[model samples]
Target: MAETSPIAIICGGGPFPFSVADAALRTGRKVHLMPIEGWADRDRVAAYPHDWVPVGQYGRMVRVARNAGARDIVFIGTLVRPSLKDIRLDWKTIKILPRIYRAFRGGDDHLLRNIGKIFEDDGFRMLGAHEVAPEILAPAGDAGRVRPSAQDIVDAKLGLAVLDAMGPFDVGQAVVVTDNVVLAVEAAEGTDRMLQRIAALRRDGRIKVSAGRGVLVKAAKPTQDRRFDLPSIGPTTIANVKEAGLAGIAVRAGEVIVAEFTAVTEAADTANLFVTGLAPSSPP
Candidate 1:
């Protein structure tokens, strides 16, 4: 696609959708923001050329994007898996009910790929957020003043191994490890909630490890479709890690999206937490 062509962003909750929109705009592309009704922030969406879309209005989504002269579409931000009843299906979605049912029979990755295929069949190209905004990807080495301790590195590697082992099962993209002990794995609740679980455990004394002793590791699943659902972190992640009593956060370099890089780094520095991007070879 030409750099000057208009791009469509199907936004979810959080700041990532705006971040990607900004990046695309910087590259001289016109952007049409389609914010998901319940998930996306209204004030932010109002700043762009946008239409509010509900979860199951696939037909309207396509029509709106086409009207806006957008051929490339990117999906970003946080959206919990909605049940069928939660979807307000229009005729287009109702016609594809069987496909949607089949898609939901598998894991998140499966559902996303099937959804993307539906769009692709409609002649719209699905793109990853990182593709439109390469600058949002995490880089190798530390992102803040702090660096991981030697033991922290070991824990991070173990966390990555755990994720890799769970990848084929489409389990989750993040884990917490302290002193080689697995504290938690991200599941339907997501990364933030998983970290919250760790924080609760520490508070209840179930996790005896000292503060600043563990690592929070996030990465893409081994067979993940990178076109959507890549792991992402931001300043909020730093806050969560600090609350979870972790030594640092480690994510796959160039694979995980770093939202609000400057704010994230500043948060990490202020909290005295390390945020490092691990190279592919760093994991076992």
Candidate 2:
């Protein structure tokens, strides 16, 4: 008797999906991938047993996963919101459009929870990246020589307060703070662009600091659906933080995903930047 593979991957944006696949493979499951078109890397996803589906083809995604012999499904990476007009939804998917549209009108958490329900109703359990790769959750200590100063810690708490307030609106998960002032808040542009804004502000002298005491704080929103869109950071985030002249980064402990954990920590150590996973603080 042959045992079924425990999981199939529904891959979207970023390197985390690939990391999920890697982790699943390490655990001896035959990790099949359902790569969403426009969001997943076809060349990379093709390395696994896969079916490529368009982002809006919810019906096809489930059928393919069932066909792949996956008992449970793992979802990893980002899916950018597309204009409704751009989606060429199939008949089965079109029927569910109203629900999706309403979800979108509400917030990201609502949209994703609805999407997860769609998969579950089709008999697949969608697991978080953290569940897929618990080893990749960033550990709860500074990962480099540079540690957040007392002021940086205060600023991180402040940023976390802001993130919590904005989370219910499905706004963003990150904020940059320095010298007890917020340098930037993540918006629709995401973390990278938000950090770039800080860099730009410094370049244009909008921020007074010549060097960098920037601390980036990333965490789950107050209403975050942890099973799907848990916050993540990796080597790229470290590089970007360095480029933005940020001294360190803090994330919600046991909630944030750290893709390429070893490489991210090594890079942070090399750059003398700190990455810490801490419990969220109350708004003070």
C-alpha lDDT of all candidate models, in order: 0.93, 0.81
lDDT of 2 by residue, 1-284 (tens): 53346578888888888888888888777887888888998778777888888878887877787787886888788887787888879887898888778867866677788888877877788788777678878677776666878877888888888888888788888899887788888877888878888878778888887565879999888777888777778888888898889888988777788887888889988988888777544442
What is candidate 1's lDDT per residue for 196-238, written digit by digit as tens?
9999999999998889899999999989999889999988898
Query: Which regions of candidate 1 deviate over 4 angstroms?
Result: none
Worst 10 residues of 1 by lDDT: 275-284
Q: Predict model 1's lDDT versus the native.
A: 0.93
Q: How do the predictions measure up, each by TM-score?
A: 0.98, 0.93
Worst 10 residues of 2 by lDDT: 275-284
**How many steric clashes between backbone atoms does each model show?**
0, 0
> What is the alpha-carbon lDDT for the whole of candidate 2?
0.81
